[model samples]
Target: MVWRQHRIIRLNIVVLLYLMVCFVLCPVSAMTVSSPAEVHSVRGNAVTLTCTFTSTSRATSRMSVDWSYRPQTGGPPQAFFHFSSLAFPPQDGQFNGRVKWLGSPARGEASIQLLNASLSDNGTYTCSVRNPPDVHGSPTSQTVLTVTPKVPTVRFSDVAVLLAFILLPSAIITLALLGRMCCPPRDKSQTQGYHSPIEVTPGDEPGFKQINRKEKNMTCCDLYFLVWPFFFFCS
Candidate 1:
């Protein structure tokens, strides 16, 4: 009989535990929050942290979202952003004026953009959401935000401009010199050198003079001796 009583007590305990889970833990576990496991961003650039939630209930005015941050050194999380109908961004902290709300809670989003991210901002961020009757479940999600120093990069356009301004002119000049050397032009001096000497008659000779029509009476040799010899003797 004692053993039977012990069995009855055990059964009662089991039922009580089951009831507790259904009444207390089930509703709290209904809403689920999610976010990226890790994020990478360059310093001085904007980085977005996204958080979303699914609830068994529909959207309501009471729905709210909160975002917090924790340093890499590990400490208590600090709330920096809050949203319901209006957004309450970080006012005065490491993130002052740098955090902007980018989420629409009605669409199950709780994302925020961190402007001018810095190395000091390298840490973990947590997002929590609550919607009236659906406020329980996994209402919080955490993301590890990693801010890396911006590395200088060379752009394709800049490289193209460098090549165009420097290498292109060099290539054009090289091609012009090669063309001039390979196919020489036909100059008048080369062709004229191969021709015979110009033909010269007695009249064309500088020292020989022909008799004019008016002096046809003179013989050709007499005219030549009189005109050409006299001209040379006077000089």
Candidate 2:
């Protein structure tokens, strides 16, 4: 009897372990929220909310998807959406006649589109999914909808515009100044009439006369010729 009881206890332990293993091996359904969770919507424009999910079994048309909203300060989630009987409710108050389901539920898509979004719709939103007996959990995602007032954009103050109009021209002027400083202008005065010594001939012009060095009362032209050799050597 003692051996039989021990065997029974061992069998129970094995059964418990097998159950635990089955539970551990069960796959968890996954849902994904795309980036840029928060989106800005213009008063007259539309915006779309995107999400993705994966599961071992194919999603059917009967699957339930619920989109809800909770204020930024936090509170009970508000039921803004429900999909079970292929029915959709009219947009409430500020969002009336402006919200749409962008996804084809038969294809497992759960995206929402908001048209003509208004300021009053600004708040946090959550998306949840239910896949029947296998999965029924709220894997939530949050988004802040903001309605902005239309304002004219002043491109003059934009950084790219400033760089093109102001900074670029300033840089070009600076470069020109640097170039001028590095390369000084040539001296036109010094090179006005430089004649080669070989090209110069005595009495080339019809002067009055060439006087000998022994003559007195020497003129400025005489002094110039006398010092020409010295000037050439100094240069």
Candidate 3:
């Protein structure tokens, strides 16, 4: 029983020493940072890279945050941003004038926005956070960002609305105007006058009246003579 007690106490002591050594190695921070595994963005647009962390100790102005990037083509990581009480943006390379820091160390937030992203911007981004006098724990996190081409915005509904409100009405009105110009309506009085062959004054000429009476009497006499032959044959 006495031997077992001594061994247990020794084991606890060794564990405490190991933790102490790990704490001493990175006294400035004992933080864990995490980010999404994947992020998507459109070409010529912007995307947010989120990195949140928790410190084992209280937050302070001395806290520092760093961001680095590695391309999909595979190469050494490039440091682009740093925040040690104040922001230190990237000075050179493709990220120059394109990255904006969006972190508040006191709140345990360390994020950034990449503006005007291009196809070449597809890569892995890493975030590291440090706060003083704490045992370090998982101080780095990574996120993979993918940039895709923008899709066309024209839709079937948009075309339908344009035709309904603009094109269709314009076409109807144009056809109506053209028909009116090509074949105009005519007045009834003008059409009746144009069809008549001659204009006669009824009571203006006695010779015309005499000719009418003579023609009427000759028509009766010719009819009587034509029926007399048929009557004689029957008798």
lDDT winner: 3
* Clashing pairs for predicted structure model 2, backbone only: none
* Candidate 3: 10-residue stretch with minimal lDDT: 190-199
**Which has the better lDDT: candidate 1, or candidate 2?**
1
Query: Which prediction has the highest TM-score against the true structure?
Result: 3
Cα deviation in Å at residue 171, candidate 2? 37
lDDT of 1 by residue, 1-235 (tens): 9999999999999999999989886654378999999999999999999898888777777888999899988999999898988998877988899988888766788899999999999899999998877745688999999999999999999988977788667655654665555435645563333432376553454323322332354444554455455434532
Window of ten residues with lowest summed lDDT in model 2: 205-214
Candidate 3 lDDT, 93-212, residue by residue in tens:
999999998987778899999999999999999998877765458889999999999998989899889878886676556546655654356455643343322555654455556555
* Best-to-worst ranking by TM-score: 3, 1, 2
How badly does each model clash, as a count of residue pairs? 1, 0, 4
Candidate 2 off by > 4 Å: 1-21, 27-35, 71-76, 133-138, 152-235
In order of appearance, the predictions have TM-scores of: 0.59, 0.49, 0.60
Model 2 Cα shift for residue 226 (angstroms): 59
Model 1 bad stretches (over 4 Å): 1-29, 172-235
